[model samples]
Target: MLTPMLASLLPLLLLCRISFCQYSSDQCSWKGSGLTHEGHTRDVEQVYLRCSQGSLEWLYPTGAIIVNLRPNTISPVAARLSVCIKPSTDSSGTNIYLDRNGKLRLLLREQDQAQGKVHCFSIQEGALFIEAIPHMDIRRRITAFQYELVSDRLRVEAESLSAPCQPCSNTDMLLAVCTSDFVARGSIKKVDQEEDHSSVTVELSRLYRQKIQVFVSGGVRVRSWTGHINMPLQCGVRSGEGEFLFTGTVRFGEAWMGCAPRYKDFLRLYHEAQLQGNNPCQVDTD
Candidate 1:
């Protein structure tokens, strides 16, 4: 004998289990479509399905054709385009279209046609999904865009644009030590500025590498290019009464600061080099 509440919950639990098993065994397949713009006609081919264990499937349209030239049959200024989806009994088959607002929509229909080509489109949704390559006017200038589909989700990523070029900082501690002419722990005594350059005087406390004559008590001037010239320093040494690790070259009577490592970071790198039986001063090209 079953209670009324238990009998009511039994049907719902069985329905959930059946749905889960169906999704686990289901495989994705693409439905083909014909795209026509002006007089140019191309067939969009179906691709393989990608599915994970107990996850939603993905149907990819890998053979979607891209036509560059517009036909003379249509107007040169504005060309009309149409996409006709092949009829199928599968409920997963969807008609992909671009609304007037340039948004992608997945509708359950036998066929769909549009006026213009869309930037993105999908052939199916839910358990099975397919996204066409984005074809925007501005995409011509992009170098590359990465596309990925996982568990019925589509992701598109574009490479960063380049303008106003800047130099990248050197992150390798051992490489910074090998390329530098002088490495020491010092305190900034004064900062002097000119029309196009600035100089900072530092009092040395400890010397790690001595390419030139450096005194512990004497002041050392470090020159840096400023103003219009863009020589951005990676580690800035302020004119306060604190000790800092300095790495740079000494030319004439001034030291050109290229890198300034923190005390703890410098010590960690120094010990790591020693434990590996490698010299920090020697450059490792490999």
Candidate 2:
């Protein structure tokens, strides 16, 4: 809610002096308590975080916080970076906004934070303004979310994880194999359709790389990997398929399909690129 009070509140929050900040040299993540300013409910604090990806947690939120997010790497690409935040499922107690200069734009209401949806904005937009929603009993209140700086130009609006309806080009596929969060050889074991997306279970024969522990390795004797990838429902992806090379990005702890082609096709393309000395990166297909 853009109450008239917010207009006045914005300036106060923005101009607030640096107080007891929960920052570190690396400053990737921040965890603090609004109880620190418990007596001053109208007080404000500015938090600076420099990282490509990180999280913030505010316990017992009382006053307000201005979260300034910036990428650690300083370059022209920083201007093009999109800051995406996924609210914690249990997050509550504060309203979030985009604060540009003294102007405020609502990003998320306190209640909406419970839905745990992802939100994106350009780095040039503004710092995040999170104001505590006044409540008598702030004992059980907390506001938290994970943020990521997405720089992929292919992702028109920062939803870069999910592939579109059309298959990726040979060149994109090659790049994805090299740059994706996870690269694996697998087949669709199950496909569970959802309202907005489809969850595909991949029975992986080999997991060459993973940015995180998305795939689990079975016991030593069993020797296997299994993981799930989300895809756009319109892709019409099904369970039946030959072996495929799966390469995709991970967003908010979930894998999303990217450039995936049949294993044979990828082998052929890789071999051709290798002979031409044009492969972006090498994969040990052997």
RMSD of each: 22.5, 2.9
Query: Mind giving the per-residue lDDT tens digits that candidate 2 earns over 1-286?
Result: 5665465565565456433543434488888887777545776777899988899998988778889999877899888888889899899988999988767789898889987767788889899989888777546878999999887453442453343576689898899888888999989999999767899999989989999999999869877899899888878888885999998778877887888899999999999999999999888988
State in Å the error of residue 28, model 2.
2.2
Instruction: For residues 89-111, write the lDDT of model 1, one tens digit per residue.
Output: 23122233322222224432222
Stretches of candidate 2 above 4 Å error?
A: 17-26, 136-139, 152-157, 160-164, 275-277
Candidate lDDT (C-alpha), each:
0.35, 0.82
Listed in order, each prediction's TM-score against the native is 0.30, 0.86
How far residue 149's Cα lies from its native spot in candidate 1, in Å, is 56
TM-score of 2: 0.86
Best candidate (score: lDDT): 2
Q: What shift in Å separates residue 129 of candidate 2 from its native position after superposition?
A: 0.6
Q: What TM-score, to 2 decimals, does candidate 1 have?
A: 0.30
